[model samples]
Target: MKVIAINGSPRKDWNTATMLRHALQGSADRGAFTELIHLYELDYRGCSSCFACKTLGSPSYGRCAQQDDLAPVLRRIEEAGALILGSPIYFGQVTGEMRSFLERLLFPYLRYSREKRSLFPRKMDTAWIYTMNCPEAAIKDAGYDRVFAENERLLKMIFGGSCFTLTSHETLQFADYGKVDADMFDPAGRKARHEQVFPRDCERAYELGARLAQNISRGLPS
Candidate 1:
């Protein structure tokens, strides 16, 4: 069995990547082949808005017809038992690349006919992890709850799978507080929160991964 973690952060070694790695490591510990795909390392674009996948009797049904770096990754996801998508919130939503990836990944599976169902029939479990500088109390300030809920709904609808979500709030923003302008953020507060909560978040991510693998192995919802 395979489980893939897609990291949509520009900084491969940043908090977002670290959290994803922890999750992947957990999947690995559970005996699933785990791989990490970093979007910043790839050259790709969002969906092209082509109707090829939607064309009647199209061979590309349920698959992205676009020729890009993400195509193969999509195939891998289609074959995998579990998926973990991690991103640092950018301007109140997932980063542009992550959003673009989602557009390509999900749009093709949408069917318009009566009894519409995703063309991809495989059962896969998914987890979405989001990291942000804002505290949990401010999560609604950006209105991400709606977005997260919608995406979770779509993942289940399209893949006939279960989905889980993790959010790491008040993430560490700056590595060196002394060199940067500290007026805009409370470095001390961030430090305290990070020291107290980030590790626990990582543990949760690890548990999520292991549980997803276990559930997928048993052909059950995660």
Candidate 2:
């Protein structure tokens, strides 16, 4: 089985990327072919509201019509047995790049009819890994939990498979806070949590990936 992880953070070596790497490592260790894609490295636009994907008798039906860097990535995902998406929360939601990526990835397969919900070719497990500077206790108050749940719900509906979410909270945002004028956060506390809590979060991500691979191998639902 092949497991693919998409990193939606601009910084390739930051928290989101690190968690995704750990997840991919776990998948690879479980005898699954694994690949990691960085969305920022690809030049792509969000869906253009083109109805080609939904138009009857169209060749592009059930597929994204735009041809760009994301085209091949989406095709690769079509072949994957499992997928993981990782992003850092910005302004109470995922980054702009991730939002655009989701638009391109999900819109094509979404059916307008009530009888059928998705046009995706097969059933596959999916997971979302989120890193945020906000504390876990504040997630509900901030309404970020709804965002996460909505994403999971959409993935489950579109792919016809189980979907789960993992979140890393109070993430370290900078290597040296003194270099910037961000006085709203305590740099020392964030560093301490990164050293203590973030490692545990990475371990959780790894376990999530390993479990996904194991389930696929065993013909079990994730």
Who wins the TM-score comparison?
Answer: 2
In model 1, what are the clashing residue pairs, if there are any? none
Model 2: colliding residue pairs: none
The lowest-lDDT stretch of 10 consecutive residues in candidate 1 is 133-142
Instruction: Kindly report which residue stretches of model 2 are placed more than 4 angstroms away from their true locations once superposed.
Output: none
Model 2 C-alpha lDDT per residue in residues 46-162, reported as the tens digit of each score: 999988999999999999989999999999999898999999998988899999999999999999989889999888999999999889999999999899999999999999999
User: Lowest summed-lDDT stretch of 10 residues in model 2?
Assistant: 213-222
**Residue 54 lDDT (model 1):** 90
List model 1 lDDT by residue over 78-195, tens digit each: 8899999999989888899999999899899888867967877777889899999777886677788988898799888888788899999989988878788877888888888788
TM-scores, one per candidate: 0.95, 0.98
